[model samples]
Target chain A: MKKVLGVTLGILTAIGGFVDIGDLVTNALVGARFGLHLAWVVIVGVIGICLYAEMCGRVVAMSGRPVFDLIRERLGPRTGLLTLVASFLVTLLTLIAEIGGVALALELASGVHYLLWMPLAAFAVWLVIWRVKFSRLEQVFGLLGLLLVVFAVALFTLGPDWGQLLHQATRPHPIGHENWATYAYYGIALFGAAMTPYEVFFFSSGGVEEKWTRSDLVTARSNVFVGFPLGGLLSLAIMGGAAVLFLPAGIKVETLGQVTLPVAVALGKLGLAIVLIGVFAATFGAALETALSCGYTIAQYRGWQWGKFVRPREASRFHVVIIVCLVLAMLTLLTAVDPVQVTEYSVVFAAMALPLTYLPILIVANDPDYVGEEKNGPVRNAFGLVYLALLTVASAAAIPLMIITKGGQ
Target chain B: MPGESGRVLHAQLHLLDRQLIDQADGHLAGKVDDVELDLDADPPVVTALITGRERITARRIVDITTAVTVSVEDLDLDYYDDWVENHVIAKIPGARHAPE
Candidate 1:
């Protein structure tokens, strides 16, 4: 029974932990504009992340080393340093976006401007990281984040034409005066939102923090296989809600208010309140993950002692890094930039940095010395290689598409 | 150890940039940022592990499996760790204790 409970908890946290500000904004934005025409990208992205995250868990479980450690070891210092800088910048940008997201959620709840709430949200994030146990921190945010499942509830309550939604999902294309460039740009953004690189860094390091061993692989696999797909379903529901409400009405999802409006229309003020809390939990959870990921990547690269499993004094450098990152994020958000815009750019840049993060993981996962008998098999390698190719294409095209579409207009 | 075991290990592949684990507490110390080589020897041997740009003699090495295990007194390779701890994190109220 304890074992079953552990597996269930892992799956629940994984599902809840999956969505973030990027997923929230991008899905609603895409749905508002393109309907479900780009739903196939989400499926492809879910599979990719599951495959990548599974390999990351396996590596950490077997080798007891997190992803960045292996990244430096496999890629060599010069190339690894380049990857580090790129990944760090992207993660930091994501940190800023998440902080902004938390403030926005607060603003939606309290009616104060989001900018007024930025520092408080950031400080709360830092305090949690400083004082909370790793397990407690993860479980609290992850479980609360499940409130986002209200998107599905709202969609069902809205009573949309399921057959038409499926038809749009099956046939992929630009919709309603949208060109292929904008469609493709949003497609990459959605993909990046789904398979954000920080997810891997946080997942692997969390495994190591939880002291997962080879015996825990079953729990890990179930989390990835069950939790993530269900999370993807929630993302689809957000899209469906937007598609049902906003697409036909010629409304674009430009703000967090619009993202929550469909739920309000479908399920009333009670639903809006629930969705606001859900958005708060999701964004706040992501803020913690991105903040820690900044420290994890840098410390692991430098081979410094890191992780909340140890006392803050023990991992002083790591804690300091997190502090510095939070300060920077707070400062960035104070510039009065739109958090939604930051979310869009962060995901696009995440798309650009995908290969830098995943390529080394793929290489190390196949290394016999690191994972020993658990090295990648032919089928895993086949999918791994295919994903690598796709990531490379996405990375190469991300910037150009951003420019051509003028940042998705 | 590689020479003793008659195993040919490439520096880039096996040593450089690998993690250095402190065996005493099983905490990470640093990376094998570079290696000190005995160039005068016929086939140059790795004399020490350079971690955080500081050379720790190979005699402190406890084992070399996937990671280089080193027996060191402080495992804080450089002053940076201490500086950060003392000046920043340790100044915080709950720095010394692990979260309950």
Candidate 2:
């Protein structure tokens, strides 16, 4: 019974932690603009994330070092330093988008402008980091985030034609008046959202924080296998709900309010209330993950002590980095720039940063010193090679695609 | 570094650029920037270690430098006052042991 409960909680957190402002914004926007035309990208992205994240967890368990630490050893100082800068910036951009998202969720809930909520939202996220236990933080938000299941419920309530939805997903191209360029742009963005750099850093570092060993490998693999696909299901639910309502009505999802409009229409006020809470929990939970990811990446590279396990003063540099990142994110949001726009660009850039960390993990996963006997088998390496080519293509094409489509117009 | 015997470990692969930790308090002292050894003895003896900040510093551009040759016996966790220990030694899940 205890083992079941332990594994269940891990799976729940992985599912919840998987979605963030990136998915909340990009998935809905794609769903609204192109219906299910780009949905295949979500499947591709989730599989890619699972493969890399598993390798990272295995290395952390075997080497007692996070992904970035191994990156330095494999890439040398100059290349490692370059990887750090690129990843740090993308993570920071994601952190800013999440903080803005939390503020936006608050605005929807409280009927106040989101800008007024920015500082307070940032403070709340930081206070939790400073005051709450890591496990407790994971539990509260992870469970609450499940309220996003409202999208799945609402999708069923609307009673859409299932075959047509599946047909669109299978065909996977621009629908109606949508263009090929914009379709490709959103596809890359969805891909970015699923395989965000912070997820790997946070997962591997979380393994170290949780003290995983070779014994825990089964548990870790099970969590990824069960949890992440469920997370992808939730993302598709959001997209389907949006497609059934917004795409037909010609309402594009430019705001968080539109993202939940389907729930409100399908289930009335109670569902809206529940979905709002879900948004709040998902974004706020992600804010914590990205902020801590900032600390994890920087500290792991510098060999500084990091993690919520210690007194704040003991890991002084780590704490300082988190605080600074939160402040910078808040300041960026205060410029009145759109959070959704930041989210779109962040995910695309996440694609660009993919090769930086992913390449190192793939290389190190093959090394005996790091992964021991748990090294990548033929099947895993085969998938790894496919993703290597895919990520390289996505990274090379993301910038030009973003510019070509004018950020998907 | 491990339980295996009669295995060859490469210097660049195993020692260089790996994290350095002080075994006394588990505080991260630094990374293995460079090492020094005495060549006079058969098989040689490590006289001292060079701690340079540039190679390991994350905040600045890395300073280009030539490699140094060092001859030393690689000791297990029990021998060295400073060492690297995998986070696995703490068996409990989410136990909050070994922050970095």
Candidate 3:
């Protein structure tokens, strides 16, 4: 019974842990603009993340080493340092976007400017990282993030034609009005949103943080296999909600309000309020994950003690890095960049950085010295390699696609 | 020690940057930054390993003493060095045949 409960908790956390500001913004944007024509991208993104995350989680569990640690060992100092700098810059940019996301959530809640709340939000994220225990932090935000389920509920409440929605999801083409470049651009964003590098960094590190050994591998698999797919469902629901309400009405999702507008249209102001709370929790919760992940990637690379499991003074360098990242992120937001725009660019950058993060995990997971008896079987290896090739193509094309589409206009 | 039983291992291939886990408890102490080789015999062998932030700093920086003196002075240097020497520098059990 206890084992069952643990597996259930892991799944719940993964579900809540999955959607972030990127997922919310990208899914809604694509849904409103291209309808369900690009829904297949979410499926590809979800599978890609699952394959790599499972590999990373297994590597950590069997080897007792985080992904970045092995990355440095395998790639050597110079090349490893290069990957670190690139991954760190991308993660830091995403952190800035997430902080902006949190402040935006606060603005949606309180009617105050998001910029005014940026410093306070940054400080709050730092305090949680400084003081909270790993399990407590995971449970509180992970479950609270489930409030995003309201989007799915709102979709059903709106009572759209399920057959038509299914037809659009299956058809995979720009409906009469949109062009191929914009459709492809939004497809890349959805993929980027789902398979962000920080998610794997956080997931594998969290597995290590929880001390998941070989015995705990089952739970880890359960979380990825069950929880991540459900989380993908939540993202799809957000897309579906937008497809139903925003696409037909010729609306573009520029603000948090439009992301929740379908909820309001389906379930009135009360449902809107509930959905707003969900959005706030999802974004702020992701803010915490991404901010901590920035520190995790850096400290793990340098072999410093990290994670909320350790006291701050004991892991001074880790805490110091996180504080610095938060301060820098807060400053970045204070430059008055639009949070939504920052969120969009961060996702595109995430798409561009995809191969760097995934390739290392694929290499390490297949390595017998690292994974020991539980290394990737041939079938998993085939899928992982295919995804690696696909990720390389997607990453190479991402920037050009962004420029050509002008970020989906 | 298994580290001594083997022929001279390639530090970069076999040891450098691998996690330094406590043999008894599996607590991750640090990584193998650099190894100390003993040349007192006819053929030199790596006698002890150094694993600490200060050691890492001292190896890379010219003025590590000036930099670490502030933090190191507070530490019982002899005891700290002994602790790192005994506990954190053991050989990885299955890492010997790792392909270069």
| Chain B: TM-scores of all predictions | 0.80, 0.38, 0.43
- Better model by lDDT, 2 or 3? 2
lDDT of 3 at B14: 57
Clashes by residue pair, model 2: none
Q: Give a tens-digit lDDT track for model 2, residues A65-91.
A: 788888887887779899999999999
CAPRI grade, predicted model 1: high
Per-residue lDDT for A263-372 in model 1, tens only? 89988989999999989999999999999999999999998999999999989999999999999998888878888999999999999889889988898889888788
Candidate 3's error at A236, in angstroms? 0.5
Q: State each model's CA lDDT, in order.
A: 0.91, 0.80, 0.77
Clash pairs detected, candidate 1: none
Off by over 4 Å in 1: B2-7, B39-43, B74-76
TM-scores of all candidate predictions against the true structure: 0.98, 0.88, 0.87
Write the residue-wise lDDT of candidate 1 on B55-83 in tens digits. 78867777877788988875457478879
Off-target runs (Cα >4 Å) in candidate 2 are B1-8, B36-48, B53-100
Q: Candidate 2: how large is its RMSD?
A: 7.1
* Candidate 3 lDDT, A320-403, residue by residue in tens: 678789989988788898888888888888888888778778888877777888888999999998988887887888889888
Ranking by lDDT: 1, 2, 3
